[model samples]
Target: MKNVSLGLALFTLVACSPVSQKNKGKKYFADLLKDVDKIQLKFFNHGDTLAESITDQTEIDIYKELITGKRDPKQKIKCDSTGEILFLSKKDVILHAWFSSRATGSKYDKACVTYSVEPESYGSALTVRSGQDIDDYYYKLRSTANRMAQH
Candidate 1:
């Protein structure tokens, strides 16, 4: 009876443990930005400083949409993180995103994010690739950083 009870308890624990599901037909990460007021883009290679601080509501919305874009079906094995963007609500960071590319001039992109604010699927590391759109976004960021640094 003691062994049976232990086995049952172990089975229950295993059954109740939450599993991290792959981001297939799902958003890349949870929406932890409802209270986010600013989105700051920081580049790793470009002096690792704050490149842009998007406080405007319109721009914030646009960036949020771009950040929370769909994930690729297959998991690609490349992580050359170019930079990270911080989603902030007031002075606090809500979500921190690390963006990467498979290679320079490649269309593959990856986002490894950690949320300061928790959601249902919180604490799970996810990688999302959106091909050309992501590549374009990265170039836009790099160019913006370069353009701003010149002034």
Candidate 2:
């Protein structure tokens, strides 16, 4: 019967489609942090200048945990960046984390950070707002950078 044939064809098409394969699970921003030995935290002074890189493993680990631990998925993608953390392995930058400034909060501000695998290609990457537990880390880093810049 045509009905049976059509049903079989549809089933085959659905099973072989790329969407079906890609839908195994949702990929989060934290997925890109794997195997990164050194994470360089570069604080931005109002998007004008970048402070010195923080390479200490202890500090880097703290930031890594704070950033990847909790995430509030954000639908809105755009934000004013205040700082970024580069996830590196063997001296090669693997991922870039662009975080919003505390001073530039809007009505919808929930403390967001965008993670990009490629440089300057955040439009297709994952952007997540921080949960209550990890919200102030961005501001804290910026303050630390400001103090460093003064010296």
Candidate 3:
């Protein structure tokens, strides 16, 4: 009877959150922002890590737009960031650059963690991963992402 009661309790908790269930086959960054005592929006690799912080609202707005914006399918995308763009976070520091990658030879174009701003690839989005669902962060990003199409 004790086992039955425990199982029932578990079921109730799980059932209450269909969103949790929907995320079963999916992945989320469980710990990217865990110990981050400081929340900063800074440039990843613009010039200097500490030098470029996102203090301007317009800059943030532009980032917000970029995160929410869809890449042009015909763009044959390559993320060079033009020195002032493509910024995303790695370890509390948002870098405008991504780690090295090789072409997978798949239909998908070459992608980096910071490069994928589309909604469908929610898993690696710089905004989503760094935010990592902390303090309902995904809500805003997801809202923007919803307007976009999958790769």
Which candidate number would show the highest TM-score if scored against the true structure? 1
> Residue 14 of model 2: what lDDT?
87
lDDT of 3: 0.35
Pairs that collide, model 3: 44-94, 44-95, 44-96, 86-96, 87-96, 88-95, 89-94
Residues 86-134, model 3: lDDT tens digits = 3434444432333212221113334323333222332232343232322
Ranking according to lDDT, highest score first: 1, 2, 3
List lDDT for all candidates, in order.
0.54, 0.53, 0.35
lDDT over C-alpha atoms for residue 37 of model 3: 30
Writing each residue's lDDT as its tens digit, candidate 2 over 29-121 gives: 446555567866555554645444546665555545544423234645455565566778778887776655444343235445665432223
How displaced is residue 71 in candidate 2, in Å? Answer: 8.2
TM-score of each: 0.50, 0.49, 0.27
Candidate 3 vs. true structure, TM-score: 0.27
Best by lDDT: 1
For model 1, what is the error of residue 15's alpha carbon versus the real structure, in angstroms, after optimal superposition? 2.1
Which pairs of residues clash in candidate 1, taking residues 3 or more apart in a chain or in different chains? none
